[model samples]
Target: MASHLLLMRHAKSSWDDSGLSDHERPLNKRGRRASGLVARTLVARGYAPDVIWSSDAARTLETAKRLIRIIPGAQTVHHNPALYHASANTMLTIMQRESEPGGRLMIMAHNPGMAELYNLITGHYHRFPTGACAVFKRIGKAPWHDPQSWRVVDMVLPRDLEAE
Candidate 1:
């Protein structure tokens, strides 16, 4: 059996109010446009997740909510407070807790955690710019935690699909 995980970075956020805590900042216009494009691309490619886990922060939540609404087969998007600014290790722990073993799982989060998690999986640098998504597909029945069990499937960036 094979499984896949989509690790994504929250879309671009507004920094107009420096007073707002990192968690309170919201996505800007470009962010919304870019994330929307990414969402449609996921649905079109049939790589939408069965379940989505997103950080509780405003930016991440907005991104996840928008994406989930359009993900072809998606039905639920959960906000996990633990995922807010969660580190790569915390993300790994979350993956280990899943009840299912072989379905697409999407994590909406921030970087350097998103980039860090990608590095942990591939042992290479892959820029996770805002609204970026990378998928890791399992080659065998091995569990999600086993790094050797997976390989890169596909990667898409907002800039890649956005209309200039």
Candidate 2:
């Protein structure tokens, strides 16, 4: 079965103060704008997902919500605490286990892991900035286990949205 995975990095966050926990940090104004633009771009590109999984962090959740707003459906968006600061291996495991048969999956989470996961899946280094997204097309009959089976379909960053 063919499947597509969209991995997104959480939008820019506010760090004006140091007291807040990492999970509690909210998206800054620029983050909000960039996320909206990306959401619109996804809609325009017909990249809506059947399932959405996101980190429990405030910024990540907010980014997912904004993306959902553009899609407009009754799909449930899962908030997984494990995704908050998960490693690439952890993220891959989650994706492999949770992905539905022949369905698109979208995940919103944090850095190094996101970049690492992209590289692992596509076999190419991908620098994921805030609000960046990488789309992978999986063609194997089995689930998303081997990274070599996935192909990088598209990748976009917030700066790329400026040209759209």
Instruction: Give Cα distance to truth, residue 73, candidate 1, Å.
Output: 2.7
Worst 10 residues of 1 by lDDT: 94-103
- Estimate, for each residue in 19-89, the C-alpha lDDT of model 1 and write its tens digit: 99989999999999988899888887778777788999999999988887777767677889989888998
lDDT of 2 by residue, 1-164 (tens): 43777889999999976999988999999999988888787777767666788999999999888888877561768999999888899987886777454466788899889998888777778678999988878776655666776788788788988776
lDDT of 1: 0.84
| Model 1 bad stretches (over 4 Å) | none
Per-candidate TM equals 0.91, 0.91
The Cα RMSD of model 2 versus the native structure comes to 1.7
The local lDDT score (0 to 100) that residue 95 gets in candidate 1 is: 72
* Number of clashes recorded per candidate: 0, 0
Score candidate 1 by TM-score against the native.
Answer: 0.91
Clashes of 2: 0
